[model samples]
Each structure stands twice: as C-alpha cells, then as structure tokens.
Target: MAKGLCALLWLQKLMTELSHSHDHIKHIEVDCHFIKQNLDSRVIQFPFMKSEDQLVDILIKAYSTLDKLSMQDIYAPLKGMDGLKDEDHRNLIGGVVGEVQQHFPDASFMVFNFGDQESQSQIPELLSDMPVMNYPIHHGDCPILAMEIIHHFLRAADGWLSLDEHKNMLLVHCERGGWPVLAFMLAALLLYRKESNGEEETLHLIYNKAPSDLLRLISPLNPLPSQLRYLHYIATSNVHSEGCLRYKSLTLDSVILRFIPCLDAEVGCHLMFNISGRDPHNLTDKTPTVLFSAPERGKDIKQYKQADHKLVKVDIHCPVQGDVVLECMRVRAGLEHGETLFRVMFNTAYLLENNLMLGLDQMDVTWDRQNQYSRAFSAEITFLEMNPAAS
Candidate 1:
C-alpha cells in the first residue's frame, strides 16, 4: 500500500508536468522554483540559462535576445552544459515561448499562405537579424520543410556559420515550439554536425536519426501531403518490418483495391502508405492521399471494429484506376516472429509494369537489437495493371 501511494504520487507529478494551464499549482510552477531553490541552497547548481538562451525553448512562453546569433555562436554560453557538447547528442531543444527577434536586418518569418506572409511582415520591423521560419507543418513534413527553410536562409546569406565557429544560429518556433520545431532543429543540427565531420548530411541521415514522437506532434500542420508521406517512410525505416507486404488492384470500375498481405506473426504494428485517387481515363483526379497505421491481423485490428475502423483504414478510392501507388513501412514487430526478414509475392493475374515495383530493388533487413521494440525492413514489390476483362 505504501508503494502504491508512491506510485500514485509519481503519476500525479507526471500529470502535473504534462498539464498546459500555467495558473494552477497542479501545473507545478514550483517545479522550476524547486530547481532554483536547490541551486541556491547548494543542494545543486542548476545551470541557469537566461530566457533568451534556454536550449529547451519550447517549454517557456517567450524570449528576447539582444542580438541575432549564428548556429555555432549560439552555443558559446552553453559550452559547459554537461550533456550537450558531443556530436552524438541528438537531444531536442525548443523555445517554450515566442522569442523577441532583434538585430538582423533582413531576417523575417514565412508561413504556407498569404495571411501568414502578411503577419510575418510585422515581425521584420521588431527584429530583423534572423529568419524566423514559422512553418507549422504536418507532423510528417516538419523535418523536411524545416530543412528547406534553413537552406533558403543559408543560401540567401553571404555564408553559413560553421559548427565550430558558432557565429550564428537559427531560432525557430511553432505553436508550442515543442515537437515540430524541436524535431526539425535537432535533425538539422545532427546533419550539420555530420557534415562538419566530413560526412554527407543526407535526407536518409536526418530521417533515420530523429525521434518519431517529435514528428507526430506536428503532423496536422504539414503544407504538402508528400512531406508527410516522406516522414512515414523515415519512421518506417526506423522501426520494425515483419511480415509486411503491399498490394495494388485496379478495376475497370472506380475502385482500386489494395491489400496488406497478412502476416503469420502475431505482432502489433502500424503501416502507412501514399495513395492517389484518380480517374483512369480523365487524368484529372490524380491527387495523392495518406493512410496511416491501420491494423492488420491482430488484437488492435479487432479493437478497430469496436471503434471507428475508418481511423485505421489505409484505403484510397477513385472513380477510375489509371495507376495506383502502394508503399509500406513497418512500425513494429511481435515476438512471435523470430526473424526480421520476410518475403512478399504478388499473386496478381493481370500483367503490369515491373519497373514500377521499386525505384531500388535491394531489400536489406536489419534489427536494431538495442531497441527490442522495433526491427526495420525494406523491400520492393512490382505493381502492374493486367486486363480486368481476363478476371
């Protein structure tokens, strides 16, 4: 019973930490005070960072720095931070509050639409040293979109601040500045670090390294469906792929049927795909859509029926089936599946183009044994449209 009470207290503390309302003790403003008090009492020396320089900027409400900083110079004061220095530290940093932009003359904010563009004009007047890119992307597009904005800022400038030079840094914000902006900055930092080490800062590196939870937090605001889909690809590559398969079926009718081949493994997982809805003859309705993590052959699949099955369904429907694109990335695998690799065979009666199967055909399946929670796999399957009349 004593342990049970402790557990409850711990849970309550966690709940308090997660809460958003700032006015209540349940929200625990004292937590910060406690840290400060401990530092002052010599109980601990909490590294005190002024609001302007706090690395975890997402938690705070706002910040105003005296001058714009290059990415490298931004870390000058933070050099002694215990866990922050190494290239391996892919830790997320956010501005808890909207920052007061000051100094840089040409720096400004940009969003997806005209309204955002207009609002950003007001930002340049207050502070113009840094480009404050506020692209609230869908959880999926956050990283890539953030990269594009960063590159734009760099190319527009005379030169980029080297990580060692630390002359200037980018200060970015999203609604809360927690997940979307956090993921993008961390991933970009990692890429920047990799490039400094004489390694290429490729899309694969950023996508493979950034945490999945960070991407999920900002998925709703993605400007383009493709950006979100690319995120799905990255997350899938990072997770487990067991008994994962993709299928595409086209009918003379408007409906295109795609099936995920059932796995013998009793594993739980999420499968995401990029699907397009189009008319075979019209070529006008060729719009792409997304289907995220619908369950297949598992208990969650059963639960899907009790709730809204549509929430888990990754199907795309169109009036006619000119072409159907199917892709799958594995999110998790069950223990029942002893191995990480599995074969997928398409049993279609119709004839279709084989080159459409995979842009690349090599399937290298590997497990990150350190994370028993996931095993990653990549495979390619060809899709072709045979004569429906034969069926």
Candidate 2:
C-alpha cells in the first residue's frame, strides 16, 4: 500500500508539469498570431539583411540579451509595463533641418520661403546659425533673378556641383508652402549639372526617376515664370561659370554675374545696338539718328511695325561690352522740354537690372500704349548663346 501511494504522488506531479507546459504553449501561440496578423496587414515590414547572412548576427540578435537586461531595469510601477510592446524608428519627431544637421553637422542651410515676416522669422528660430533669402513679392516681375539665386547655390562657386558634389546640397523645407520653389530649384540643379537635358525634359526625369511610392509624395507645384527663364537661359548661354566667387552669396541681390563661364572668360562685353523705332519724344531734327546693324541681315530704318502699334525691337549685340547706353529718342524728346516723365527711371533701370549684361540676344520693348512708358512698358530678351553653343 505505501509503494502504491508513493507512485500515485509522482504521477500527480508529472500531470501538473504537463498542464503548465500546455498553458505556456497556448500563450506563445497567441503572441505568434498577433505578429502574423501584423505581417499580413503590412503593419510590420521586415527589413532585408544580406550582411554576413547569419541568423545569430541579425539586428534582433542582440535584442534578446539587451532586451532582457533593459526589461529588468524597467519600473514595475510604470503604467502598462506588464506586456511586450512593439517599437519602431518612426517615433522621432524632429525638424528636417535639425535632423540633417544631426548627420552632417557642417552642412550649409539656406531657407527659401514666401519672405513674410512670420514665415522668415521661424527660420532663424529653427536654425539660429544659418542665413535667410526671400524670393521677393514678384507678382508680374521677371522671376529670373530669383531662379539665378537658386542656380548659383546648387552649382557652387565654380558651377560644377552635381549629384556627387563635394558637399551634398540636401534640399529640405518645412510644411508645403515652398513646394513650387523646391520644384524649380531642383529642376535647375539637375539641368545645371547636365544630369538631364532641358527644364521640362528634366522635370519629367524628376517625376519618373523617383521610386513609385516616393514619386507620388511630391506636390505638383507648377513651374514658376522665373524658373522658365532659368530654363531658357540654361538652354541658351549654358552659362556654366567656373568662376572664383564660389562661396555662397551673402544676400539675394548679391549674384556673382562675373562667374558666368562665358563672361568670366571675356574681358567684359562688346555691344552693338539694333533699335527698331525712334523714341517718339526725341524730335531733335538735327540729331543724327543711329542705325542698328543686324548680323544676319543688313541695316533697316528704325520705325514702328505699322506706324500703329508702339512696339520696338532693341536687338543689342555685345560684340565688346555687356553695358549698353540705351537712348530712346522718343523719350529723350519728352525729357528735354520739361524733364517730366519719370519713365526712364522706372523702365530703363528695371530693364537693365533684369535682362542685361548676361549675354542676352535682344531686349524687345513693348512700349506703353498709354504713351506713359510705365503703363505698358515691358521687355522680352533672349540669351546670346544657348547652352549647347555656350558649352
């Protein structure tokens, strides 16, 4: 009887161990099901690792050891500390500029925004060390000036920076306001480096070149007018200046025009004028009217297209110098009498600033219909040589 009783006690102990093992196995199965569901739903994507191809050397290989140690240090009193919790790297919530600086501490930053006081003020707050450049409120004004600023920075001082440039020009912006600017800026960069053919051509490359999912991430910011001019300028002069003023400009207006490859190689500019119409105000009967010599065609008398539309083609050739003193005979005739029309101040100065000295083909004056010059005055110009010719 005593032997039989001892045998029954051992059997009972074995049954209890089996029961505990069954419960532990069920718990593991439940955990595995959760993981499998997440995988099916794509909530969890396992990163592929080809390094060494060792199971023991996997990313989570150290997890088992370090995790246990880490768990031991976890405070039991903390809320929800009883179960295993999945973690990911997506928890990082930092500013873009800040994150970039974390990786490349010495990287230079230039923020392009709407230039409103509110938006610009945030830049210094985010990056205290970096400087700021405003795109200016150019409603109908030429945006080439703005585009030039961007093209200069991306290409560096010598205009040679590319995808593999010495210092990477990591483009970043906060929110979505600067999407249009970014689109133009990036397109210009790609064109400058010759990584792509033309603006629209390169823009397509930007769209198709990206990964499918990430490609959809871009905002369809329409190309700006200034950006279009950049394309034209690039296509025309291919002004790839490998000049010495390689360092970034200090201000938006501080473009190193001397760095244009063609201009940089020359002493200055050579100028030859082709004025189509005599400025109406200049009525000096005795004054010698100048004649414009067309390179392809012979000289023609400067006059209105049909004596109705007040349009004039000012085809200037820089055979010697980029600077040309434009004397609108019509305007001069207006000035000598009373010095009244401030048209010269507005029209002449702006025309020079926006479309002069960079080897432009011509400045076509769309004279003001109102006869005030300021009301309807506009100039359309082209580059001296397209990018192919310049190259």
Candidate 3:
C-alpha cells in the first residue's frame, strides 16, 4: 500500500509541470502576434536573438562563475519580448536645438527671413559666425519674391553642406518653419539619403518622421505656411535661359519686386512668379509684351498658349554683388496712383547668371503708363547690409 501511494504522488507532480509549460507557450504566441501586426503596418522591426545568447550569455559561454550568473541576471528582464517604438526626429520640442548641439558640436545653422527685419537684423548677433540670409521686401509691391528665396537655398547651400565635414549642422526658424524651410529640409534629406543609400530598400520612411504635435510649440502669432510652393516649382518648371526668369501668365503689370543682396552661393535663393490675363483662352506666348527665353531656341518674344496657363521655373544662380531694382510702367484699366498697386516682376534666373550685374530696377515707359525712373518723389531710408555678426 505505501509503495502504490508514493507512485501516485510522483505522477501528479509531473502533470502539474506539464500544465505550467503549456501556459508559458500560449503567452509567447500572444507576444509574437502583436509584433507581427506592428511590422505589417510599417511601424517597426524586431532584432532576433535567443535570450540565452543575449543577456544570459554569461552563463553558457563564460568559464568564470561570476560571469555566468551576471549574464543570467541581465537577460532575466528581457525574457518577455516586446516591440520597439518609432522615432520622430523633426519635432521641435523641449529645447531640441540644445540637445542636438550636444551630439553634434560642429553643426551650423542658417536663418532666412523677409518680413521680420528687426528680428532678422539681430540674428547674426545671436548666432555668431553662422550665416543669416535675408530677402528684403522689394519693390514694396510684388508677391513672387517668396519663390526666389526658395530656389537659391536649395541649389547652392543645400548641396554643399554634406561635404562641409560638419556632423550636426542645422537650420532653425521661429514659430513658422514651414514652406521655404520645410521644402529645403525635405529635399536635403531626400538627396542625402539617395546618395548614402541606393534607392532599393526594404522599407520607405520619412513620410511621418516629422512630429506633428510639436508644432504647437510655435507661438500663436507665428504660423507655418500652408503649402510648400517653391519645391513644387523645382519638381515642375521648364529649364529656361541662363538669366531668364520665366513663368506662365505673368501679369507683368501686377508683380512685386524684392531686392536681396549677398544671398549665400550662386543659387542662394528661390523665386516664383505667376501671371494671368483676360481672354482666358488666349493666355499663351502670343499674349503680347510677355518675355520668354529658352536656352535651346535662343531668345524669342513668344505668346502664351492655352496649355501654358501656369508656368513655373527656378534659378539657383544668385548674383552675389549688384543691385536688384524693379519698376512698373503700367497700371490696370481705371484706378488712381495710390488706389491701384502695380507689382514689377523681374527674372531671377537672369539675376543669378554668372558675370551678370544689375544696376537698378527698370520699367519700360509708355505715354499712358508711369515708369519708376520718371518719379520725382524722394525719401531717405536706412538700409542694413549683411548680418552684422556674419561679418
């Protein structure tokens, strides 16, 4: 009777051990399913390795008793596998500039501004030795100056930074680092990644790498632009003559002119111009008084075609030394001088060409139209040159 009782007790203990083993197996399956779901969604990947080979390697591979136990303790926490989180690098939150500088000491920064003259004037002093490029509100009249600033930065500065031997160079803006800055950053990263890694990869990243929520950090007074228009031009425009700035439907009479001096390199800025006319269907090369030049066909006064409704182009070449002047000769149908505003549009492509110098803004005068040179009015204004600290 005693012998039979002892045998029954041993069988019961074996059964309990098997039940625990089955529960452990079920838990592992649940963890793996979660990981697979994340991976399929392009969220993350798992680096595979046996737990024993990982933190527990001390036990199996080590000859020393202390090393074996140490490895086991380290690996103990990692026994339950888990998924990794995604990285959002572009969010501006919590003094990220300071944190980035700590990792990349030699990182450089550039600040571009047109509307913020006072703040812009002070940037060079604040970020000494770093570059600050400014675009003046030119012609006091045109709307397309924004596009000119975009092209210059991308073609000249964007390409050269990677080769500058600086590890952590950065470009920072105030509340609204949208439009111009975003386009450049995206293009720069895309170009960098393409050169660093061949096109083929297991995954496509960067679509959501920028942190959206952190934009709340910018003060309400400042807001990023809604769309990145300059990059849109780079991705779309036709190649025009060396010094020719071309765009579709250029309402030459209503363009704005901005004078930007000392834009960094040959293409130190980006420019955009758009024109429109009545007879909506006849908006082509023959639209009259509109200028279009192409390198292949040489110079020709062309008419706008029905197809050329919205023309766009960019010039990377920036004239380093000279004055950019703009003048308008004509005003729309019926409006007083002060009542109607005329925007003078100039070709930035022409401005950035090598060896070209612009002395002043010009407007072709007509008896019925007013020209800039003919004006008798005069006013004194203080002009600030390059950023003081940059000097």
Candidate 4:
C-alpha cells in the first residue's frame, strides 16, 4: 500500500487518456477531478485494508479462500514426538488433508514444511495426496542461512501461485519451535506480493496472527530485529535478479549505544558485544565467524554509570561482510556471563548512508527488558571504509 493514493490517481488518469476520443472521456475526466477535489477537502478517505479484507481480490481472482493457507499448531502436540508411532502422525496429517480437500473439492494442494530435517522428511509420507517441499530452518542463530531460505521460499511460492489456473493452493506449515522463522517467511511473502506495505507493518501483522507467547516460548532471544532486517532486504530486492545485491567488505568503525540500561550500581553497567557473520576474508567457508567481540580475553571496555540519557561508544574496527548478526549484551557484576540486551542483523550489501540506526522499538529484546530502556535508546553502527571494487 505504499503510495496507494498516487497509484489510484494514476489508474484514473490512464483510464481517462485511453478513452480520450470517446464522448465518455469527458465523464471520466470529470469523475477524476471530483475524486481529487473530495480527497483534498477530506470528504473522501482511503484507509489501508488488511490482506484478508481486500475485496478487490475476489473480482480479479477466484472466489475461494483456499488458495493460500497457514498452519501453526500453537499447542504443538506433534513436536518432539520421538516416541509416537508413525501411523499416529500420518493419521493426524491425513485428517487435515481430508478437511482441505473436502472444503475445496476441485483444488490442488502444495505443502511447504518449515521444520527440522527429520520432521520435514516425514511430511511426504504423511501427506501423499499432494506435493511437499521441505525447508529446514535452524533457530537461535545462523541469520545467513535463514536469509537464503527466505529468498528461495519467496521465489518458489511466487512462481507457483502466479499460475493462471484457479485450483492451485499453497499451504505453509511449521512445527512448534518454527514460529519465529515462519513469521519472517510469511511477512517476506506478503511484502513480495504487495499484499501488505512497509517493513514494520508487514512484519508486525504476521507476528500478531499468532498467540502472544508463541515467539517467546520458541526463542529466548527476540528475533524480530534480525527478521525485520531481512524484511527490508526483501523489500529492496529485485524480483528478476538471481539474488540480492552482491556482498561487499566494510569496516565497522564503532557502535554507539544511547540510553544504556543500568545493570550494576557500583561499576555501572558493563557492556559487551558479539558480532558474527560470513567471513569477508573467505566467503566460501559457509560457516560464520566471530568478526568482533568486545572485552577480549583480559581487556575491559567502558561502562555507563548513569542510566538516563547515556551514550557509550565501543570501538570495533572489525572487518565484516554479508549477513552479519550483531548482539549487545549486559555483563553482570563479578560474573563472566552476559545477557543479550538486544540484537541487530543486516547484510553489508544493504547498508544505506554508510550506517545503521536502530531504535529501542526496532531492536530485538525480551519483554521484561523492553520497557526498561528509554524510547530514545538506539544503536548506531558507523562504517569507516568500503571496498570500491565491490561497490
């Protein structure tokens, strides 16, 4: 719905020009002018309609709502069923297939399973009535792999759903712990299809579909920021291209944390960072490396004493490239352990203005820690250099 009003106006103008020689052109032009005047005078309003409530879809496409499906088992009885008989699982899947087929007698079904490898492997046998594609997504980490999965899923889903036939139905399924990745995938798909607009709106809309505790139960670390970063990637990506922008090497000069949350009283709040991603030095490894970690071995980084309006700058000077994950953690007093305060993930190729500024609302944090930080809390990453050849 980005520039929705402009698009509507353009359509009206195009229709008017198409019938310029006809007598009806005069009526069309007058109607267009009327619409503009009413819009300007606040007599007419165009509100954003959710994807489900878009009535125009019925006029353009088939009347059935069975074209796309989303299945997230909130209770997740099927997950971790190592001891359950295979027949039991098959019966459960068969019941779902029976229901869908009963509802749309002429429809064809395709299943996209986002789960563990073992669980995904069983999908084909369980639901032999349709085609099943497995996309195993690792949780807790590996943002690079997740991005690749998203790109592939978007392309595959778009190709299948764009067919001229009316009976094509797609069902996206995920297990108990797969909600985080599934949410990200669904948001990316919605944005790709232009059914939803804007990164935050699209992402939050998908997450809001599930129960409030679904994400927190699956992931200890809030994955929204990292997911939002990928959503932005999808928004800016070219549909005809093989992939996103080419990877580029860059130097992370420093990170500035504003409104640092106070965890300790005496020594103030000690902070640490862990930045990991595909190596800029060797891209073929496929394994992410720790590009940077503050308070290395015996060294100590600066701490912010006052919790209010405090800014702490940590110099990184680390070389990184392609799908980076940056995590900020608060170190406890006299303890080696530190808890993650927030995380930000992004690709070097997608950097704009040579920096990334993330506010408190955008960064991934636990619910308890969310309200503790000020609304102005932000993390700014500044890059010192970029490879000219790669750019």
lDDT of each: 0.32, 0.34, 0.31, 0.68
Measured by TM-score, the strongest candidate is 4
Clashes of each: 36, 23, 42, 0
lDDT of 2 by residue, 198-264 (tens): 6666655443433333312222212232355455555544355544222110111111112111111
Error of 2 at 213 (Å): 17
**TM agreement with the true structure for every prediction:** 0.29, 0.31, 0.31, 0.72
lDDT of 1 by residue, 170-281 (tens): 4443332234333443333333333322112333343333344334333332312333333333333321222222323443222121322233244444453333333344
Off by over 4 Å in 3: 1-97, 106-115, 118-120, 136-145, 164-168, 175-230, 238-391
**Global fold similarity of model 1 (TM-score):** 0.29
Residues forming the 10-long window of minimal summed lDDT in candidate 1: 58-67
Error at 48, model 4, angstroms: 30
Query: In candidate 4, how many Å is residue 256 off?
Result: 1.4
Pairwise lDDT winner, candidates 2 and 3: 2
Best by lDDT: 4
Kindly report which residue stretches of model 4 are placed more than 4 angstroms away from their true locations once superposed.
1-88, 117-120, 138-146, 267-269, 287-289, 295-304, 307-309, 386-391
Position 379, candidate 3: lDDT:
15
Point out the worst 10-residue segment of candidate 3 by lDDT: 57-66
Instruction: Name the candidate, 1 or 3, with the larger TM-score value.
Output: 3
